[model samples]
Each structure stands twice: as C-alpha cells, then as structure tokens.
Target: MLLAIDCGNTNTVFSIWDGTRFLATWRTSTEHQRTADQYYVWLSTLMEFLGIKAEITDVIVSSTVPRVVFNLRVLADRYFNTRAMVVGKPDCELPVDVRVDLGTNVGPDRLVNTVAGFDLYGGDLIVVDFGTATTFDVVAADGAYEGGVIAPGVNLSLEALHQAAAALPHVDITKPQRVVGTNTVACMQSGIFWGYVGLVREICARIKAERDRPMRIISTGGLAPLFQQAEDLFDDWREDLTMHGLTVIHRYNTHKDFRQ
Candidate 1:
C-alpha cells in the first residue's frame, strides 16, 4: 500500500492507497511539536482501528511546512522503516516545466496541485487552492508553470478581521441568506464568502485573457465546497488532488518505466 501525506500550514491530510483504489483517508491538525514516536503511536492507533497494517511499502509526502516535513521524514524512517519521497526536493520530477524565478521555493502543495491538474485536465489550467492562503496557479498550454495570484483565504481573512478589530467576532464561513447583511456576523459572512467569489472570478478572468485557448479551472483544498456553493467559477473540484499527485509522483520516481 502507498501512504500519501500532504502537510499544509493548518492541516495535515493522510491517505492510504491500495494499488488503484483509495483505502482510507484522514485529516488532523498540523502540530509541529509532535515527536516521531508520538506520530507513530497516533498513526498506528488509527491504522489499527481501520484494520490496516503498519507495514507501509511506499510513503509519499508533500509538505508546505518545512518543520513538519522534517518530522514526517523522521517518522517514516523510524516507524515505517521506509524513506519518504518528499516533493519539492531535487529528486522529484515535476511533469510540468516550472518557469518561475530561480531559487523560489514553490510550496510543495501548490506544485502537487499543478501536476495533478495538468495531468488530469491537460494544460492551459488554473488551480485555485483554498487553504490557509488561497493560491491561484496557472499552467500554460504547453504545461509550463506560469505564475498566478495569491490572496488571503476565507478562514484566514476572518481570523485577521477578528484579530484586527476587538468588536468583530469570528464567524463560520457559510454563505449567508442575503449578501446585504443586517447583523455584524451576517455582514462578515457576506464579505468573506461573496468577496472571495469575486476574487476568484476576477483572477480567473485575468488568467484566461493571457492564454489564447480556453483554460480549465480546478478548485482544490478543504474549502473548495464553500466557494462552489456561491459560483460556477471552477470547472472541477478535486478534494484529494494533492494526495493523488503525490501518488503519481511516487510512481514516476520509483518505477523506471515512468522516468522520462
């Protein structure tokens, strides 16, 4: 079985893949302080409950947090007796050509999303990841990583609002009944929800104008469903796009036939 781990800023996602099918998936809070043994204990307990063995043949990891990546590497080596194939490293082969400025560490999650988006729906694609920071990644028609936009995520924006102002309260990011809100909470919701939708549409339109051919927009990450509710801005929603990309990259690296 292949174990795929996507460690983001706010959450860490795990998925077990038995050859072609996904066996089980789970999400947990991103704790940077957790030790290798602690991670092993937690993962072992979860696997035991799910009736899965601790013997993971292959481990693939894509982490935005550098500290978590180091810890995950330790956990994989110490507990599973396997070395993880970490994305964003020199060894991993990205299917798409990255034309960004040299020395810039493109977030592993973003790169993974790009690879998956391009592989699934060819090039001239835009991947909007609604995570801690909502990022838009644009891929050219020939599968080159052309840069996109980044904006505050819905949750982060709300958090900032609450932190910046004492009177403002943190509200759950749900589309309110009306855009024009009477109450404070409702007003915050309207801004966070519809405002993000407008951001998505505007950025997507700008990216589309740059390309000659029609581009496909794919939305991923935890909060994709929230944005989907407001507008038909995205062509597809891939909840497990990052994990799937890790799996694809893992296969490409491990199997000689997949190497270009």
Candidate 2:
C-alpha cells in the first residue's frame, strides 16, 4: 500500500492506496507544531477506524507548508520506516515541463493538480484550486506549467472580513438565495458567493484568451463543490485530483513505463 499525504495550509489530507485503488482517505487540521509521535498516533487511529493496515510499503508527500513538511518527513521516516518521495525535490521527476522561473518553488499540490488536469484534458488547461488560496494554474498547449494567478480563498476572505471589520461576523460559505441580500448574513453570502463566481469566470476567460485556444477549466479543493453549484465555471470536477496525481507520480517514479 502507498501512503499519500497532501499537507496544505489549512488542512492535511491522507490517503492509503492499494496499487490500483484507494483503500482509505482522511483529513486533519494542519498543525505545524505537532510532533512525529503525535502524528503517528493520530494516523494510526485513523487507519484503525478505516481498517487499513500499518504495513505501508511506500510514502509520497506533497506539502505547501514548509513547517508541516518537516514534521511529515519526520513522521514518515520514524513511523512508516520509509523515506517519503517528496514532490518538488530535485530527484523527483514530474510529467509536465515547468516553464516558470528556474528558482521559483511552485506548490507541489498545484503541480500535481496541473499534471492531473493536463493528463486528463490534454494541453491548454486551467486548474483552479480553492484551498488556502484560490490558485489558477495554467498548463500550456505543450503541457508546461506556465504559471497563473493566486487570489485569497473563500474561507480566507471570510476570515479577513471578520478580522478587518469591527462589526462584521464570520459566516459559513454558502450560496445566497438571491444576489441582492436584505439581511446581514445574506448580504455577506451574496458578496462572497457571487464575487467568487465573477472572479472565476473573469480569470478563466482571461486565461483562455491568452492561450487563444479552447481550454478546459478544472476545479478542485474543498470549496469547489459549493462554488461550482452556483456557476458553470468549471468544465469538470475531480474531488480527489491531487490524491490521484500523487498515485500517478508514485507509479511513474517506481516504474519507468508507468504511463503505459
């Protein structure tokens, strides 16, 4: 079995893959200060709940948070007894040709999303990830990571609204029944929900114009389903795109003809 870990800014997702199928998956809050032993205990409990054995053969990690990466590396080595193949490392080989600045460290999650999107939808694709930050990754016609925009995520925006304003209250993200709201909660919802939709459409349109081709828009991350419900911005939705990409990369690294 392969253990795939995606450590993001807000949440960390863990999945156990038994070669061709994902055996189990779980999510936890991103705690950078957590020790390896603590992580091991929590993970073991999760695995027990899911009935997954602790005999994982390989581990793959993609982390956006540097602090969490250090702890995850420690956890994998100490608990799993395996040195994880961390994405964005010099030794790892990604399928896409990254055309960005040489020293720029693109988030592994974004790279994985791009690879999965391009592989599934060919070139000229935009992957919109709505996580800690709303990331727009543009894959060129030749399957190269050309880079894109990054905006404050829905949750982050809500947090900021509460923090910056003295009276505004933090509210859960949901589509407003009407665009024009009559109450405080509805007003906030309308602004956030419709504002995000407009942002998605405009950014996607701009990216498509720059590419000058028919591009497939793919959306993932926690807020994808909610936002997607209100608009037709995304051409497709893959909830576990990053996990699948990690599995793909794991296979590619272990076997030379993995793509075949």
Candidate 3:
C-alpha cells in the first residue's frame, strides 16, 4: 500500500492506495508541531472506522508548507519504515520540464498540478488552484511548465475585510441571487463570488490571447466548485487531481516498467 500525503498551507491530507486504487482519504489542519505518533493515532483511528486496513509499504508527499514536511518525514520513517518521496527536490524526477528563471523555486503543488494536468490534457493548459493563495499555472502543449498568475484567495479576502474594516464581518462566500446586494452579507457574498468569476474569466482570456492557443482550463482546490458554479471559465474540475499526480509520480519512480 502507498501512503500519499499532500501538505498544504492550511490543510494536510492523508490517503492510502492499495496498489490498484485509493482505499480512503482523510484531511486535517496542517500543524508543524504534529509528531509521528499523532499522525499514526489519527490515521489508524480514522481508517479503522472506514474498514481499510493495510501495511503501508510505500509513501509519497507533496507539500506547500515546507515547515511541516519535517514532521511528515519523521512520521513516514518512524511508522512506515520507509523514506517518503519528497517532491520539488532536485532528484524528484517530475514528468514535466519547468521553464523558469534560475534561483526561482516553483512550488511543489504547482508542479504536481502541471504534471497531472499535462498528463491528462496533453498541455496547452491552465490550472487554477484555490488554496491559501489562488495560483494560475500554464503548461505548454509540449509539457513545459510556463509561469502564470496569482490572485488573493476568497477566504483571505473575507478575512481581510473583517480585519481591516470596522463594521464588516467575515462571511462565508456564496452565490447571490443578483449582482446588486440588498444587505451587508449579500454584498460581501456578491463581491467575493462575482468578483472571482470576473477575475478568472479575465485572466484566462488574457492568457489565451497572449499564448494564442486553445488551452484547456482545469480548476481544483476547496473553493473551485463554488466559483465554478458561477462561471464557465474552467473546462473540468478534479477534486483529487493532486492525489492522482502524486500516485502517478510515485509509480513512475518506484516501477521501472510503470508505463506497461
């Protein structure tokens, strides 16, 4: 079985893959202080409830928060007795070529997303990831990782509104019935939701115009579905796209004849 861990800035997800398919997945808030015992306890209890049992023989990890990777590494080594494959390291062996300036390090999550997006769509693609920061990455038709844009995430915007403004309260994002809001909550929702729709559409349009190619737009992350409902900017949404990428990279590295 393969234990795949994707550690983001806000959340860390763990899943077990039993060679053929994913057995189960669980998510929790990312904490740098979490120990090997803490991970083992939480995962064992959760997997026991779901009736998925396995001896974790292999492990793979992709992390946006570099600080938490230490705990993840310790957990993998101590509990599973395996050294996890850490993405973004020089020897990680990604399937895509990243075209970036020297000394600039691309985020592991972005690279994983590009690899998965290129594998599925054959490049000329745009991947919008809605995490702590909204990232837009462009993959060329030939699987080159061209850089893209970054926007403030929806949740961050809400929090900023509450913190900076005196009267505004931090509210959940939702699609409002109309563009014009009748109340404070409605106004906040409309601004956040509709504003993102416009932002996504405009950025995609500009990217397409600049590249002059028919690039497929792929949206992922927690807030993707919510924004997708209000706009047709994205061609597809895969909730487990990052997980699929991790699995693919793991297989490629572990198996000599992975293609077969």
lDDT of each: 0.85, 0.88, 0.88
lDDT of 1 by residue, 38-128 (tens): 8778888898998976458878899888888888888888877888889988877776788888888888888888888877888889999
* Per-prediction CA RMSD (Å): 1.4, 1.3, 1.3
Q: What lDDT is reached at residue 85 by model 1? A: 87
For residues 141-257, what per-residue lDDT tens digits would candidate 2 score against the true structure?
A: 877889999999999998898899988898999988999999888888889899999999999998888778899889899889998887788899989989988988888888967
Per-residue lDDT of model 3, residues 1-260, tens digit only: 99999898888888888877788989999998888889989998997888887899988999988888888889889989999899997657887788999988898988888888887778799999998889999999888799999899889988899899999987988889999999999999888888889999999999999999799999899889988787777999989888888887888788746651
> Model 1: how far is 96 from its true place, Å?
2.2
Model 2 misplaced stretches (Cα beyond 4 Å): none
Least lDDT summed over 10 consecutive residues: which range in candidate 1? 251-260
The TM-score measured for candidate 1 stands at: 0.96
Error in Å for residue 208 of model 2: 0.6
